[model samples]
Target: MKGLLFDLLFYAILIFACIYVLPNYVIQRTIVDGSSMADTLMDGENLYVEKLSYRFDRLDRYDIIVFYPYGRDNTEYYVKRIIGMPGETIQIIGSDIYINGEVLEEHYGKEPIADPGRAAKPITLGDDEYFVMGDNRNISKDSRDKYVGNVSRENIGGKVIFRVTPLNRFGPID
Candidate 1:
């Protein structure tokens, strides 16, 4: 009976770690809530966000990330692609995005940006700041909006690495 009891307790602990610790610190399941990343990540799709990579490496431009807008205190999380890295100046002239006065070459934007928003003028990022935007540029409220300025490294949750739901769409996300 004592041996059985010990086994039960050990299994309970293992189950707890799998259910709580892993999801919180390792990889978590997240759902895409909007069309901001359409044609890349669609709404209602389930994704696996890995929290380990950013701990060891710096976030690179074009990496899709999930973050708490403003701060972690806010419940809502925004997923966006990093456009401008730390210490870079970002500005949008017409439909082109300029990073440090050079036009950024990326084909992620579903359509030409219709509004420059705050990015109409050059915005320099701090050492820990990153400028992000949605793939659906015209409708996405991202760094261009006053509400979701530059995302701080601390507010970043993790990188979206895989798609799980809608079985046909299951694969690694670019």
Candidate 2:
């Protein structure tokens, strides 16, 4: 009986490490805060964001990313899709997204953007910056805003790997 108890305790610690400790370095669980990423990631939806790959890799366009916009000290995070990569120019004209004068094709937006916002004019990203936007273009507070501008590569925390909540919509985030 004592041996069984020891095994249980061992397993409990291992499980705890996997659920809590390991995530600090490898992955984390975050929830969608608003309707910004709507249609793709609904408000209140849970997501498993992975940090391992991005640690030694280059981010690709269209990848969904999470970042600490208010500095790493604050806990506030924003999740958005990468629309323009480093060193590229981004602009929005009449509800269309353009990358260096080429129309960017995407299917995630909930509706046509009513406010072009700061993206009305071409904005160029530096070598270490990225332009991000939410799927719900009309209402998302993303890279278009002055404060939110192009997210620096260092501010990006991880990429969304999958959704964990609302069992009916479980699996990969894409």
TM-score of each: 0.95, 0.88
Question: Candidate 1, residues 1-174: lDDT per residue as tens digits?
Answer: 999999999999999999999999999999999999898999999999999879789999999999998699887999899999999999999999999999999999999999999999999999999999999998898999999999999999999999999999999999
The 0-to-1 C-alpha lDDT of every candidate, in the order given, reads 0.95, 0.90
lDDT of 2 by residue, 62-117 (tens): 89999987667788889999999989999999989999999999887789988878
Candidate 1's C-alpha runs over 4 A off are 1-6
Residue pairs of candidate 2 with colliding backbone atoms? none
Task: Report the number of the highest-lDDT candidate.
Answer: 1
